[model samples]
Target: MHRATFMELCDLLSPALKRKDTKMRGALTVEKQVAIALWKLAMPDSYRSVGNQFGVCKSTVGAAVLQVANAIIDQLLSRVVTFGNVQTIVDGFTALAFPNCDGMIHGTHIPILAPEHRGDQYVNHKGYFSMVLQALVDLKGHFTDISVGWPGKMHDTHIFRNSGLFEQLQEGTYFPDQKITVGDVEIPTVILRDPAYPLMPWLMKPYACTLDSSKEQFSYRLSKCRMVVECAFGRLKARWRNLLS
Candidate 1:
């Protein structure tokens, strides 16, 4: 982003925090650090290269990278940020374009370096090890309600149970007074998933499975509507390769 945009974000966030006194540093500019972070994100540069050109420590460069990235995320990205009826929460979200479709929930495997991690956290679903990052992204693929980061070895179902999304819903909090749930199985609330799994409430499914063309027409339509979330997810992954990697 341009310096003006960064400055704008800083301006927006500045109102939320108490002011601090600091010289920033010597001849090296804070803007330069910000620029470095941007460049790293735009084009995944090594921390050493970023630090070398930006005239800062590698650690500082990494910190700057995360700070600037998160700031950009916080500033530029938002929920129901895409096109659609944001009031309706769908099961899977591809992007903001179809908010009426709700959102999509999927597990993302992120490679990490936590040597001491063990048990389910340490288990690897695939041959390579990674961390599971599940997110409830809106139509625009931006996480709206929940995002859980855990080790890759964990079961998707177990992760879901532990994610606190269910627990959060059980508490009847409010993103407002209403919440919509969509999944492959049944659940125990006003909102629920499809496919009708056992021991769950609000199970939304096709009701009857048929290959004769007219079976589960509503389900087919819902799936068609939900494809927007899939597209949104594709765009999101493409935009943030580092996130999925």
Candidate 2:
């Protein structure tokens, strides 16, 4: 991460991460704690190795990591990742030839070590222990919404249907009450997904059966828009190499 970005994160997390220094020892500054957590996340280093670099023990490194993670989620997550400026997002997608599109939804598997309890549930179709991270990405490849920690064995469609996003979309409350006319029909803002997902009034998916010229053209356009989410996941895993493992 860039130094400026790292400092900004530290500033945001300071309130959550700050601890009172006791008589026995001085509390680690928020900067050091953030650094400890970032190192552990960005690199595949062990906790003992990370602690050695920071002149702390493995336990301290583990605590710092958990503390920083919780702080980020509490102080920064909702503010940074959200649906913002609905019209702007719609315009961006329109420029890409997908009219009335708000975003793209997709799910990816995050491999993990098998847990002691119910580890079988984490075994995905690939026969590996993992979890799922379902995300909605805007045209600019920013995550507008995300749902994580679902067992990897769960179908992507099942995960999406159970998400709060699904509930909001189903109730017609997630997007603004704006509509545009395409031919003789009017359509509200919609999100694009893969064929694995069920088609809904608010969601668009590519055609899977025999396709005519018009259907093929529609599917091609939808696939192009869906690439934004694919690229977003690619960039995320690339930057946080630990996620790949």
lDDT of 1 by residue, 85-171 (tens): 445444343232222234445566655554564644655866556767665555444555545467777766677667666576446
Reference-based TM-score of each model: 0.60, 0.88
Clashes of 1: 21
The weakest ten consecutive residues by lDDT in model 2 span: 236-245
